[model samples]
Target: MLTANAAAALLDTEAEAADIRTYLATQERKTLLRFLTCGSVDDGKSTLIGRLLYDTKLIFEDQLSVLEQDSKKHGTTGGDIDLALLVDGLEAERQQGITIDVAYRFFSTPKRKFIVADTPGHEQYTRNMATGASTADLAVVLVDARQGVLEQTRRHSIIASLLGIRHIVLAVNKIDLVDFDQQAFERIIADYESFVSDLDFSSVVAIPISARHGDNVTSVSERTPWYAGPSLIGHLENVEIGAEDRARPFRFPVQYVNRPNLDFRGFAGTITSGSIAVGSEVMVAKSGRRTRVKRIVTYDGDLASASEGQAVTLLLEDEVEVSRGEMLVTPESRPNVADQFAANVVWFDEHPLLPGRMYLLRTETEEVSATVTHLKHRVNINNFAHEAAKSLDLNEVGVCNLSLQAPIVFDSFKENRSTGSFILIDRVTNATVGAGMILHPLRRAANIHWQAMDVTKASRAALKHQKPAVLWFTGLSGSGKSTIANLLEKKLHAAGRHTYILDGDNVRHGLNRDLGFTEEDRVENIRRVAEVARLMVDAGLIVLVSFISPFQAERRMARDLMGDGEFIEVFVDTPFEECARRDPKGLYARALKGELKNFTGVDSPYEIPENPDLHLRTLGRSLENMADELESWLRERGYC
Candidate 1:
């Protein structure tokens, strides 16, 4: 073993000799092993990383000086330096003393290099942690010796398992604080083992260490005679990451269509699963169109072939009708074309997620409207018990049924990250609300041999007598939804335009009668209305939908279904006091009395439109004025 003087000299010599510019220019690049450092706020993860980098001679003199100054300026009671400051980059993170974003750090050893994704340990940033672990091959889960296994610990472990990361090493840090007790280490390891038993993982290793004292990191220390496992660094150096699946059915979700010029047409994206070669047979999913790869192109040059984990662009022999958000897959191992699926979701927003709410589900490159069908259950992180839940609140995890507007080709998240994972976007605000993993796709049995209906918009219009369009009106309750809808229908009738008015209360009288005023129910009601409106649009009729549509997600869903220009959102900005004075159905009175739960203008949150195509203020406007406003909007939209 090297003496203290020798170790210090070795670190100094390497730091002085290091050249970051040369390393960045010609550094060896290969298959990177991604691992996440997860633990509670006070755990010693940051210290462990700092010690590893320090011992490996990766820290230069300038960085060390800065760290030393910062350490002296903000020294804790303990003698060890505060390493958390290096990773906690944001001002809010420093003030709150917590990590928020996923910080990525790169390092290299003689045998192999690594990229570590240090994820937030807070439960609120569970989705952010998931994003990091989604691309990782292994996970380094840290825990405090005194705290043992907390709820967040189990939650992170389960998420790692669900994401298909098989290798997990539980690093119990700060063992010195617990007197390096053998019993303490064994007890924590046994409890963690029991919790991980139900999960599908390849291996689990536990190591006890004190990041501050540098015990059992690069070398085993005599202080923990009872511990017999490899050190934390040793496990990482020896961990074997098998090559990703290159033999499964090939799936490439087109993120961009590389039509650089008239002669060049290519599909480009990172390969999420399988492999492809220049002459390989590929099929465009959903469309069931097959073609052969004419050439494999890349930024470097034309490649002979591409494998899993490689990002490349491919040129097909035929100029097929493929576009961004389409999937290029192998016909033999094609994914299921599904419109409805069950997914496990981690709700992030304060507004609880409820069934029947329409939100944009982005899978691969395709974005479509998805409705929550049912809340399966909420997971209790501490004990892993699943209880039936009706709604999922902020920082809650649950399983639910999702119904998309149209068929989408995808695989189970367990099968492929590129095809199985999706995000829920609010239709109105475009805010990312939730992250979901597809569990299973629902299928419908069809035996009918009816001729394929290849009807065009013109053919469909002949039956409905008008062009298909979505007229959306959004505002607070008692903002003339019913009145404006009635007037619009009268006007359209006089103009010989086929029209259908999906007046909110009228449909609730039959279609959505079972729904209530709760936030979850309201979301579902709007989703149902949007679906009906979409069908009416497909039937080639001028469909006018007048609803409060308080949620941004519901409005976005309607827009996605109709695409751009087909769906129009009109804002009716009437003051709450004025709408209440109208007392259209005594709703405002009920809301004031607290008889209505999640009322739009009461307990529930309403997202006001920032830029609606037409803004109509009903407070001071007469009935004729409102009608005239609607008429002008229709004319501008070419409805007349």
Candidate 2:
């Protein structure tokens, strides 16, 4: 190694200094690697990061002095310099000796520049770890030597694999605590390999190190004479992160339409994958309009070509109606355009995900109304098993089917992360609640299309000389909803009104025969009935629906399907005690005897309607009086 004084003297010549500057500049242009550290709590994740920075001489002299003093005052290493203090920068973290958020650091060696994300180890912050791993090229998962492979180790490993991390380094830390025994290291490595056999990582390497003592961090350690492998920093600097994206088909999502003047019209966005050249044939994904590239424009100047990750503007030779939220791609290779897809999602909110509730889905520049149509299963992080689930709670990973109000242009997340990933935003609060990766579009979404007709709802209603409407009745079981609805339909039919009645038990005998009494099935049951009611109203008939749709979310879903003033929610207000005492079918008695499960009034809950259009108390009233009251209200609203 050259001395400091000699190195300064060598740079004294102007020509030599210029040559050295050129060499350093070239090194700065090398490829970058993004990785994160993850493991169980107190597994030395921050210590490993601090050791890399300390051994590489990246810390300044003043910072080192402060670190030495801080070590004595607050460090957990017992009077020695606590390397972990370098990474746990937050005051709370330093005081509590834990990492709660994702901390990012930037540094460079001669071979490569790195952006390291140190994530929390607690199970509560698993969503935070997923956020860090979304864009990572590799992962450094630490395992304590004494603990060997743990449940958290498996959790982080499975998450890293799910996020498409190609490389993984198993750093068995604190080997010095075990006297650097070769047998201990081998046992940990064997245990790790056994669980990771099902993962899709291209490379998995093991290294033994003592992060507190700075052993085998940046250089090879002499303590482990039987081990032969590159150090942690060596492998990071030399690992080959393939450039497969550069070879795939070009994809550019138009973010803005730049029309500075009458002479120019350009589409501005970043090329997310592959490259584009002037005069190449391109297609607008949303409109399926083909055009040739006329020019590539950038702030620097016009260019003949642009590659992946470059943000530029392109002018088309032919006039095309391309706008924001549309995609530009090669005609020969296009992504799937569909309104329904299957995806892997990680829920991040406190409120659990309930099906049929509308949420905002944003992918790239497109934002559309979406709903969780079905929850297929949730993954068991411990053993990678799929368990049946109706809803996803906080920090749960599940495979779900999503239904969007409009189609979007996207590729599989494995092919292009930029276009294939999406997030769910709560519509009311406008908060991001979940993140998802698209697996594939459902085959039926591509095969089905709405067939248009000349005669519409307006024409049908006009021909019938009446407005179409849906009268929805909701209440607890054993209530008089079915009785009142049947009488109201009979009254409307006598008055020359087109009417149809869709009762709960009648429809369940055929349309919803396969569904059970679980909460998930209950939501689905109401959804099917609401859809059928909507179809009948579209045919210009006043439809009457009677069901004990107990959940408020399901009721809201039905109301949202109809036009304003078209859906009338009638709450048949009858107390649960009154209904249980009545027990018209003896269902509540059976539930009380432990002969029935999921009985609405006996076991399950019934969410009362907060604000119903019509609240009718049927306990002390006659059926004819209730039916006449509903008929008078419909007549006053000009429905009959």
Q: What are the Cα lDDT values of the candidates?
A: 0.80, 0.89
Q: For model 1, how does the per-residue alpha-carbon lDDT over 1-640 read when each residue is reduced to its tens digit?
A: 9999999999988876676645654555544567888866667666677677777788889887887776665544255566666766676766666779988888777666788887888878887888888788889888899999988888888778767788998988889999999899999999999988888888989999988778887778799998888887788888878644545678898889888699998888988778889899999888899999999988899988888768899899997899888889998988877888888787877777878777788876888877888888998776778998888887677888887767788888878766898989876667888888888886541222236668865688776555578889888888876677778789888888888888887889999999887777777788788878887877788888889999776777667678557788888788888888988789889889988767888888888877777778776678677877777777776656
Residue pairs with colliding backbones in model 1 are 356-524, 427-553, 427-556, 428-552
- Give a tens-digit lDDT track for model 2, residues 1-640: 8799888787677678798999988777888999999999889999888888888789999999999998887799997888888889988889889888888888888888899999989888888888899889999999899989888888889888878887999999999999998999999999898888888889999999889887788888999888899999999999988576566899999999999999999999999988899999999998899999999999999999998889999999998999999999999999999999999888888877767666789988899988899889998877788999888888788898999989999998888888899999886568889989999999999999999999999899888878899989998888888989999999999999999999999999999999889777887899899989999989999999999998876787788788888899999999888888888998989999989999887788888888899999878888799999999998888887
Give, for candidate 1, the lowest lDDT window spanning 10 residues.
443-452
Model 1 Cα RMSD, Å? 6.4
The clash number for model 1 is: 4
Kindly give the stretch of ten consecutive residues in candidate 2 with the minimal lDDT sum: 240-249
- C-alpha RMSD by candidate, in order: 6.4, 5.2
